[model samples]
Target: MNILVAHNYYQQIGGEEQVFLAECNLLESYGHSVYRYILNNDQIETTPPLELLGKTIWNWDVYQEMRSLIRQQNIQIVHFHNTFPLISPSAYYAAKAEGASVVQTFHNYRLLCPNALFLRDGKVCEDCLGKVIPWQGIQHNCYRGSKSASAAVVTMLTTHRLLQTWNRQVNAYIALTDFARDKFIQGGLPVGKVFVKPNFVDPDPGIGEGKGGYALFVGRLSVEKGIDVLLEAWAQLSTKIPLKIVGDGSLASEVNRATQQLRGIEWLGRRPMDEVYKLMQNAQFLIFPSKWYEGLPRTLIESFACGTPVIAANLGAMSSFVTPYETGLHFQLGKADDLVTQVEWAIAHPEQILQMRQNARTEFEIKYTSSESYQQLIKIYEKACIQ
Candidate 1:
């Protein structure tokens, strides 16, 4: 199979970027001729506002370039990752116009919400879910907290919806989980076109010993991530159970402050993947305090691959992987005290936690291995070709 993968990279390297690279590698490893076309958000800095806005809605350059690439290279499938501000839906039209099947992964709620996170004012919001125009997003200045920026996103979404580009241009839409798929369906994507495909950890990190006595939290330290709850829980948690925080984000200063004020809290800002895996391998359990309806975070799957049980907030995708006393424990979403309770419970029940480690690893092997993911992806590509 000849495949062309398209993505718009974020400035700060994140999970979406990881998934894009991982999928491309997986396809190539299986003998598919994969070519990549990527645009970075760093380009946004120098681009004029009017030009960027026009490109965001529809990039003629991307459309022309993609058509030529797909046609000349005889690309069978075009798997899209993130095409928010720059690549736009132009890529979708280009792929289809060139007779190439289109497969877009719903990495976030960009189609439904201007911000793509279904988050605002530090809470989970659904104001724009089923709306035709999503004016609520612009009213609240949701995207980047600027009404102009939010309006740009809303215009992009509304323009496509008006054109029926989502249902017409794209053949297959990959939702990372059942929850996300349901949301996308509600957000007006065709039901049959949407498919669930969770993220997978490649080259398996192998099971860890859990010998490290500290609990670990690895993700963006931002509001929607429930960083406040995580920090507060750590502050109140027993000092006997140390907590190690990784990753940097908008709340880096806040996290650094917490590390200084709270006892037994270690702040390691953005370690390399090997080091993160090593930390996961030795941790007591992984802590995920996300408050939003996440699109199947890659870190959670990686934790499962590491055989490290997770103590996660009982929100959408967070609760899916963490089955109480099975894979890991679930804390009440946004409740610092409840998170502390779960952490304490894990500390008290060492034997139970050990069993959870095995279950987590088994779960990963059953559903999230590279081989399993590759097979599922191939099926999606086949379906996309005929859809």
Candidate 2:
């Protein structure tokens, strides 16, 4: 099958891009023809605000380019990973006009919330969930803390809603979790169009021994990731309990300060993928302290593939990802005290943690392998095409 896969890259490299690359590679590895269209958020730096807003609502150039690609390549499927603020809803219309089936993977809740996180003031905010206009998101300056930026997003969503673009143009919408799919439906995506498909770990970083004594935290060091709660919990933990931190983001300075002040905390900053997988393999377990409703973070699934159990906060899509005492333990969302308790339990119950390692690997083998994800994706594409 010939497919045109498109994605909008964030200024910072993240999991969504990883998935975009992986899925393209996956298709090629199986002998499918793959074409790619990429736009980067770095472009936002130079684009004027009004022009950006106009382009975001409908990128005429992108629409023409998409139509040409579909017609020339005879593209059977146009699978979109991300199209916000750049590629825009116009691309979907282009696909439909060219008679190419549209398959959109919603890595976040942009269709439901202007911020795409359903988060505000460091907590889950659903004021705009089911609203057609989502004026609440604009009122709260939800997108990058700028009312103008928020309004831009609101205008795009509102314009699309009024045009019925989301309902008629796209044939399939892939949500990373059932929770997310439900939320999108609640927010007005067609019920039959939305499907649940979790992200997978590629290249199979075989199960680890879980021999590393220190706990591990790998992700952006931002407040939304519950970094402050992690620091507070670490402060209360025994100095002998070591923590290895990886990745860099908005809270890099605060993480640096924490490493300096705390005895057992070691800040390794950002490491390459091999190094990260090695770290995951060696670590006893991974800590996912995120506060928002995630779109199935790669870190959590990667940890499971490594046979490393997680002590993740019980919230969002992650709440359903980790099964307590089975694959990993869950702590109360945003609660330093509860997180501390879960860590203490893992420390005390080495036997159960070992069992969890087995369970975690089994979970990966059963549901998160690259082959399984490919089959699921092809099924989704076939369904959309038939529709």
Candidate 3:
């Protein structure tokens, strides 16, 4: 199959960017001809605000280029990763115009909420979900903390919705988890068109020895990530279990401050992929304390691939993967006490933890391996092609 994979790269490289590249490589590895149409957020710096706003609604350049690419490449499927602010929904129309099946991955909730995170003021807020025009987001200046910017995104979402672009142009939507799939349905995506396909670790990092004594936390250090809750939980622990945090974000100073006062917590900031995988391979378990709905975090999958169980917040997609007394365990979201209790229990029961480690690795083999993901993706592509 000839596939044209499109994505608009964010300034800060993140999970979405990693998944986009990984999926492209996954397809090419299976002998599919893959072409890329990628744009970067750096272009926003030079672009006029008004022009950028207009482009967010519809980019004629992207449309023309995509249509040409589709026709020239004889692209069977056009899988889109991210198209906000620049590429827009115009690419979907271009693919349809050129008679190509459109498959969009719902990496985040951009269609339902202007900010795409459904997060506001350090908590989950769904004020814009199911709304035709995300007026609440515009009022709150949700996108980049600018009402004008928020208005631009709202306009784009509203415009496309009114034009039936999302409903008609895109043939299939890839939801990263069943939880995310249901959320998108509630947010107004076509029910039958939405399919759940979790992200997988490629090249099979393989099972780890799990010899490292410390627990690991590898993600952005932000308020929504429950960083404060994690710190408080660590402070209350009777037995100070070593905790290694590896990531940088808005709450770096807080992490730095906690590391100074807290004996067991160590902040490693951001590390390369190779270093991160090595850390995961050796770690006893990974900690995920996110408070908001997530579209299946890649870190959790990576942990599973490394034969490491996760002590995650019982919320959203994380809950689906981290089963109690199974692959891993979960604590009440944002409850420091609950987190500490779970941590203490996990630390005390070494045999149970060892069993969970085996279960985690089994979960990866059965569900998250690259081969399994490839087969699932092919089925989704075939469904879109038939449509």
lDDT of each: 0.92, 0.93, 0.91
Q: Cα deviation of 382 in candidate 2 (Å)?
A: 0.7
> For model 2, how does the per-residue alpha-carbon lDDT over 13-47 read when each residue is reduced to its tens digit?
99899999999999999999999999999999999
Candidate 1 residues lying further than 4 Å off, grouped into runs, are: none
Candidate number with greatest lDDT:
2
| Model 1 lDDT, residue 38, Cα | 96
C-alpha TM-scores of all predictions: 0.99, 0.99, 0.98
- Candidate 1 per-residue lDDT, tens place, 10-33, comes to 998899999999999999999999
Q: Let me know the TM-score candidate 1 reaches against the reference structure.
A: 0.99
lDDT of each residue in 35-147, candidate 3, tens digit only: 99999999999999999988999999999999998999899999999998789999999999999999999888899999998999878899999999889998999988999
In candidate 2, list every pair of residues with a backbone clash.
Answer: none
Superposed by TM-score, candidate 3 places the C-alpha of residue 55 at a distance from the truth, in angstroms, of 0.6
Q: Deviation in angstroms for 104 in model 2?
A: 0.6
